[model samples]
Target: MRADAQRNRDHLLAVAGTIVVEEGVDVSMRDIARRAGVGLATLLRHFPTREALLEALLRTSFEELTARASALEASDAAREALVSWVRECVAWTTEYRGATELMAAAIDEPGSALHASCVTLRAAGARLLVRAQAAGEARGDLDGDDLFALIAMLAWAGDQPALAPRAEHLFDVVASAVLTGAGGR
Candidate 1:
């Protein structure tokens, strides 16, 4: 991409990020284009669909989270690593307001633009959960899918205005439930 085009794309992504945080993943393409001071055609040219735009906007952060999981995998404190990754996932999901819905949908739909990222993220968390379980720190009953559901549940709690105040407490509760032995870290 040319410098000017790259700048234009960056500007669009920045505006879209702000709108996504304020509104949600459901915000229209037209609204994003208008907010970015660009033609809808330009936005569409760069990102053919809403999913594509969201994938572009969210991909980097998702990649970073996955990498964080990989880094955490190296830690000997398996339970801590799993809890930390779960916390980070919930935090990131809440940041995008309605992203949990997208993630939930994407996980089951391989055709979706967000599918690969969502699957990779789930796998990363699963690896952590498995590590914790192997170390006899986390519950043996829970699997990767269960871990993902917990993340979505916690993120949903964080998204609700009423529940937002108790999100941290709920997180603690959920994290403790996931971990075993010394009552989790």
Candidate 2:
């Protein structure tokens, strides 16, 4: 990773993100290379496959979510933080229409390209869940694994056209159930 190479790699990632968001994952590698101002060979050298490129792109989002979890726990009360984070997770995971199912599959299959990103997402959630449990705001019986499942389900529901309208209501219900001990609040 020399200075010039790093710069080119960063540019590729930036352009790739913009194009993917605007056009889609189906955008051609040649288009990405052209937009990135890099050679096709360079792009291929950096990301050998579409999945590799996508994995690199999604790493940033997963890192942001992890940082957000830490920030929420630092600033908010345990109950409030837990609820807020669940909403954030739902929105983040559903950012791409089909990302929820992709993430769910990645979570189960350790060898998937997105497995590391999924792990980070789950760990961020588990941290929130642990804090809520410690404060007795959430159920002690549940763990981060359970929280992850709930998040995946919520993301899937959020992306559905029919279910989208009911998504917020579903979140409220799920949050309430998780917060079995309101601590008399």
Summing lDDT over every window of 10 consecutive residues in candidate 1, give the lowest-scoring window: 176-185
Task: Quote the positional error of residue 106 for candidate 2 in Å.
Answer: 1.9
Candidate 2 segments whose C-alpha is farther than 4 A from its true place: 22-40, 182-185
The 0-to-1 C-alpha lDDT of every candidate, in the order given, reads 0.94, 0.83
Q: Give the per-residue lDDT digits (tens) of candidate 2, residues 7-49.
A: 8888899999888766666688999999887789999999998
Model 1's alpha-carbon lDDT is 0.94
Task: List, residue by residue over 37-96, the lDDT tens digit for candidate 1.
Answer: 999999999999999999999998999999999999998999889988999999999999
TM-score of each: 0.96, 0.82
Error of 1 at 108 (Å): 0.6
List, in order, the clash count of every candidate structure.
0, 0
